[model samples]
Target: MALVFVALRVLLGGFFALTGAAKLWPLSAPESEQMKALFVQFAEVFPLKLFGYQPDPMNYQTTVGWLELLAGLLMALGPPILQEISNLFLTLLMMGAIFTLACLKECLSTCIPAIICLGLLRLLDICQSLVQTKKVGRYCRKKSVLKKPWEQRVSSCQL
Candidate 1:
């Protein structure tokens, strides 16, 4: 179980880090521009337009890229609580990406990797929870076994 968690964390962390870095590349301007346009469209779907705070499209993409990189680093550190939080964050990020793509009538090809990464994070979280529960159950059972004979002896003497 620990090994599985470790593998998941490493794989997800590396994947996201690489993806975020790729987005930051100047040579990827075209791809980044496309992402920015998608984000603009997504923002329009909300009330962001009314606020007169139209996020600069390129800035938005860069910010999201940096966020992904940070989240990936957090996940790689293997803090259970932090991992869970980061997983949720990444999931929401992916949801936003999916929504943006859908709004643009784009195919799933580009976003599929992010979707898969989010799914993997969710799966890892579930497995980690299950493993922790099992460990706690085992600890309790061991504690009960160690106390039972002494408890019985004490009761017998009272009788």
Candidate 2:
């Protein structure tokens, strides 16, 4: 199970890192205008426009891209808690991606990545809880065993 979690985390992190880097391409290339135009179109067509929060397309791209990049790195190499936090942020981003695709009437296949990531995150949560539970049980058992000998010694000294 731990192996599975590690494998999934690596795969998901790599995917996000690549995707986010692609999104950031406009930041340092001649394609900035074209990419901005495409993102503008996307923002216009997606559900965000319906909420009266029309953000500048470039800002949106930069924010999401950098967030994805950071989160991906954390998920890949950080401690378990940080990995979980990154997973949550990535999950939210994926949900937004899925929602946009749905709003555009994209094929169901377009949502598969987000769905898979969500599933992996849930599984990670469950596996982490199980691992923690086992650790606690082991600690309790050890503590009880150690306490018995100490108590016996103390009583013998008192006598």
Candidate 3:
């Protein structure tokens, strides 16, 4: 189970990190030019507005890039509390992406990746909660006066 979470962390973290790096472009990456062109086209098409103001296209993209890179790294390597926070941040980002694509009437395929990422985030959260709470198959077996010998289970399992 631990190995599974480790694999998920690597896969999701690497995905967001690489995608973010692609957007920011280190100037040496082969696809930097293409990514820039793509972002320009995206801004032209999407026209995202914040506080009723549209931001500069490159700046907006850069902000998102840095966010993804930092949050993804934290999600992968941070302490448990930070991991949970990063996961929530990334989940919100993915939700925004899906909403943008949907509002633009983009093809269904464009939204699929965001949907998959959302699913993975949910899976990680659920798995982490179950592990932390020790609730799967965990039960309170304290003896009860009125309960049958075979049916004394309760909800206070903490051992």
Candidate 4:
């Protein structure tokens, strides 16, 4: 069970980190001509254009890039509480990505990453609940009632 979570964390975290890092390049090194060209090309695309990519696309893309990068890092290295927060952010990001891909009339293939992230989020949630349930069951069993003196006397009288 732990192995499952570890694999999901690596897969999802690595994917988000790489994609987010790519989006962040323009923000980090604006002086680079290659980065500028990449930004321009992305801004001209369907989903980015919806964000008014031409005038100031870097700011928008950079904002999203930061979100993805931080969320991915949190999922991979932070505590369980942080993981939950990261999951929420990643889920929202993926939903928006899916919506953008759909609007562009792109092939369904492009939406695979978003779908996989969402599925991983659901799986983590289910695993967490199952673990909690097992813990609660053990706790309940450990608290079984102890026999009282009065109950013992009543049983003796009955006999």
Q: Candidate 3, overall lDDT? A: 0.78
- Please write out the lDDT profile of model 4 over residues 1-83, one tens digit for every residue: 68877778767777777778877764455544665564454455535456664545566578778898888888888887887
Task: Put down candidate 3 lDDT per residue, 16-128, tens digits, no spaces.
Answer: 88778877876565577676665665565453454466656688689889888988888887888988888999998888778767767889988899999999998998888
The TM-score obtained by model 1 is 0.72
Task: Provide the global lDDT of candidate 4 against the true structure.
Answer: 0.73
Q: TM-score of every model? A: 0.72, 0.73, 0.73, 0.69
Error of 2 at 61 (Å): 1.0
| Candidate ordering by TM-score (highest first) | 3, 2, 1, 4
On the 0 to 100 scale, the lDDT of residue 144 in model 3 is 50
Cα RMSD of predicted structure 3: 7.5
lDDT of 2 by residue, 49-72 (tens): 777777788888888889988888
**Candidate 2: worst 10 consecutive residues by lDDT?**
139-148
Which should have the higher lDDT, number 2 or number 4? 2
Cα lDDT listed for each candidate: 0.75, 0.79, 0.78, 0.73
lDDT of 3 at 156: 37
RMSD to native, candidate 2: 4.6
Which lDDT value does model 3 have at 155?
Answer: 32
